[model samples]
Target chain A: MTLSPTERSTIRRGAARARTDRADLHAILDAGLVCHLGVQIDGSPRVLPTAYGRDGDTLYAHGSTGARSLREAAEEPAVCVAVTLVDGIVYARSLFHHSVNYRSAVIHARARAVTDPDETWRALQVITDHLAPGSWEHARHPNRKELAATAVIAVDLGEASVKVRDGGAVDEPEDVEAATAWAGVLPLRWSWGEPEPAPDLPPGAEVPRHVRGRGVR
Target chain B: MTLSPTERSTIRRGAARARTDRADLHAILDAGLVCHLGVQIDGSPRVLPTAYGRDGDTLYAHGSTGARSLREAAEEPAVCVAVTLVDGIVYARSLFHHSVNYRSAVIHARARAVTDPDETWRALQVITDHLAPGSWEHARHPNRKELAATAVIAVDLGEASVKVRDGGAVDEPEDVEAATAWAGVLPLRWSWGEPEPAPDLPPGAEVPRHVRGRGVR
Candidate 1:
């Protein structure tokens, strides 16, 4: 399904980067580990970086119930959540054309607080597994006390848009021909280093396969 | 000088992670390559991931004048710019305590469009140097036409807050002791791979030293 771009979700600038395919939206969101949740608090804008997960067309975001933005989203969720993957830094012949190659998914939705306990449980599991692939089964699940402190908000992917900027820089014709400076892309890679175990952990514990495998991406 | 956290800038939630030093805010902002610019567009929230630069107590963001959010910011700069660096994933004994170790700086200010040509040049330079350390000197500088197409917004760092979460998981007493699950952190690192030259670049155009040095970070 192609995302239906409303007046709010429409890409006004750099229309070339805007994508319509819903699959592209999901792919960009899935590849990202964090999202910036945008909401208004007392007439002021606030953007907080948080972990998110996608379950089909719904995006799930969880935070402490005590969070002001979460509470505001629950009350009135005309919110924007953006996930961006910075792929590379493009160096152009002229500084004017220097840009970053990135894939960003922005969703405009009325995020409703997940009220059903079962759904909350499932949403938390999805969020956990999204961050750490096998952690939901490997680690201890959230108990009642933890559940009470958490608030999960869900936003439909109906009004979402994906924008991607790739390839090398686009310098002006004259600058490209006249300039002697180097022009290329410095691609950014997200890598994982050796895992550091908790100091309190008992001796002889091993890093699980799921934890080790997540490094490739 | 320390950041003056107004009512809007104060970190109400997770106050334990809130930082007071202005230098800390600078360090966090400097270490990041992109900032999530948040604003209310037609009374609905919107957050766009864009590159930003820090110059002492002021942050600079540039975009096309045609962007709706940039225009809104120009009119009333009550904007929230967020920069986050995710250091690692904290695996806890219980799902309740799972979190990401990160450093995030959120600035709340009225971002005014830089109309002064001299200031715009400097601001662009700061931005270019922040993204690509030596590009400003090595690459061709922007001509007048290119400068006219860009809109640079400057936000004072006076009303910003830094929040950092580090170290191990904070599990409940029982969960920490009773749980036999693997508990630690999976550290995330940003690594730069071999620089891929643009297809149009002539052969044997060597990668500059500045580009090579940036990889260490």
Candidate 2:
């Protein structure tokens, strides 16, 4: 299914960078670990970065029960969530043409506070799996008190937009003809380094294969 | 100078993670390539990722003149900007303790639309230098038409809060005593890859030393 852009979700500026395919939206959301949530509080807009997870078309975000942003998001009429990944820096022959190659997804929806016990449990697991591939089974689940202290909010990905810019810089014809300056892309690389064990762990506690073999692009 | 957190800038949840040092805020902003701008449009919050630059205590963000978010931010009473850098993933023996090591700065201010020509030129250079360390002097500067087509806004760093989370997971004593599960951190590494020259560049156009030696953490 393709995305049906609403009046507010449609991309206006740089329309060529917008993607309508639902798969593109899903790909951007799945690859990101954190999302910046925009919500209105006291008639002012506030943005906060928080962990997020995706299950099909619904996006899940959680925070402490006392987080004002999450609380406002649940009560507010609408909220915006943005996930961005910087792929590279596009260096052009002219300053005006310089840009960043990136993939970003923005969702606009009315956030619903997840209070259903079963759904909350599933959402938490989805979040854990998103952050650490196989930690749900390996780690001890949240106890009753812990669960009560957390707040989960779900927003549908129905009204969303995805934008992607890749490859080298797009410079002006005149600038390219001059050839006096170098122009290209400086690729940004993200990787997972060696895992450092917690200080309290006993000696020789094996690092799980799930984390050791996990690949980050 | 220390950050004097205002009523809205003060962090309530996880107050321990909040840093009062202005240097911490500057470091987080300097290390980031993009920032999420939050603005209220039509009584709903909108969050968009955009390139930004910092000159001392002033934060500048620019976009096309026709951009609606930038327009709203200039007209709105208040806006929030957030820059976040994820350092690593903190894996804990219990799901409740799982967290992310990150440095984030959130700024709340009334964005002033830059109308002065001199300030606009300076802001553009600051943004260019922030994205491509040495591109301002190497590349052709923005012409009059290019300058006219851009919109720049400046927001002070006066009402800002910085939050940082580093090191390993903080888990319960009971979970540590059990010691059945592996717990630690998976460091996230960011680096700049070899430059990919633009397709239109002539053969043997040397890459500048500034571009070659630029380091990203």
Candidate 3:
């Protein structure tokens, strides 16, 4: 469908991607395991892909204490969290006109370090499980010493917007036939492959049902 | 291999896979066609993904004069360019330890608007063709009116870093066997699918060989 400027977040050039909505936001977030943490470090901007978890309007991210991004976010006033899923490659007649149809959300807000031990402990679980469904329950819990060395930051989802692009390419009617260049989309997607067992596992550790059966969303 | 603090950037409680570097950076950027352009908007952060081109040490981005991001970047002192590529799922024995290995590049730099018509025209061609490989030659050249409304921004590529993680899950030796969870990476990759011709094309418009046989970089 044709998207107008008004529908696309008040930004004239950005298409609102009318087919997408808020629930699409949740599915995109939940279906993926990583996000790029965009923050300014020492006045320079950086985008780092890290593990993230979302609980309603707030999203939590954590990393090593010594990491530059985590340290900066903990001390800074705010940061931007961007999550994107490239659904397909939208190829057009002209090379200059190629684009990707995708679903993405950018969240801009203040982030604060979780200093309370109880909160940090809980946040870590959310983060771990966000990465894998049952891994948190099966893995070793963090000890006091290990917990003390980590940096965890939480950002509310107040100032955010989702931009998505889907469907076949939209070519100008006038140029349709004269456009001799093959003008269509080459769809792109990611999917799970056969499971590979860990090298150190005993010879016959059968693949867990939940993981072996897991498919890309 | 286990990455040490000195080798990979660290976060306090973040996982080992979160640490990434230069190889990861370029791979991510080259794998995709566009990136999120983050600039200060209304005294806060605004991010919009637009078409971009990379020439070794410099990044070029351009859009219609009607596009707000180009206009804002032209006026702002600095902007952030980020490219992120998610390769595949890294499923580990413990849910808490599950991660996605990716490559990302974040550039923090001052941006300059290309006011010269000659430069603007060429940059537009670069940006256009970057999106569509051979389109510049096929599409109608921009008329003076169209040219008058275009905006181009140049970002110097310096002081940027690339981080990446690849291969299998790293788990404690003891948990290796007891970890009943299926533990191996589902190798992920991006490739071009068969092209779909524009529905409006003439009855016998042959797909250009350059566009048809090309593989996604």
Compare the candidates by lDDT and give the number of the best one: 2
lDDT by residue (A108-127, candidate 2, tens digit) is 99999999999999999989
Query: Which interface RMSD does candidate 1 score?
Result: 1.2
i-RMSD per candidate, Å: 1.2, 0.8, 3.2
Model 2 misses residue A16 by how many Å? 1.0
Residues A159-188 of candidate 1 have per-residue lDDT tens digits of 987999999888788777875888888989
Give the per-residue lDDT of model 1 (tens digit) for B90-128.
988877788999999998888788999999999999999
Candidate 1 residue spans exceeding 4 A from truth: none
User: CA RMSD for every model?
Assistant: 1.3, 0.9, 4.9
lDDT tens digits, residue span A1-217, model 3: 1222232244345545533355656677777667777666655555666788877667889877777777787677767777777766666654334567787777777888889988787788888767665656655666566687678998876555667787776765554656545566666656666776667766787777656666667
Residue B176 of model 3: what lDDT? 76
Which regions of candidate 2 fall more than 4 Å away from where they truly are? none
- lDDT on C-alpha atoms for all candidate structures: 0.87, 0.92, 0.67
**Candidates 2 and 3, the one with greater DockQ:** 2
Model 1 chain A poorest ten-residue lDDT run: A208-217
TM-score, model 1 to reference:
0.97
Work out the iRMS of candidate 2: 0.8
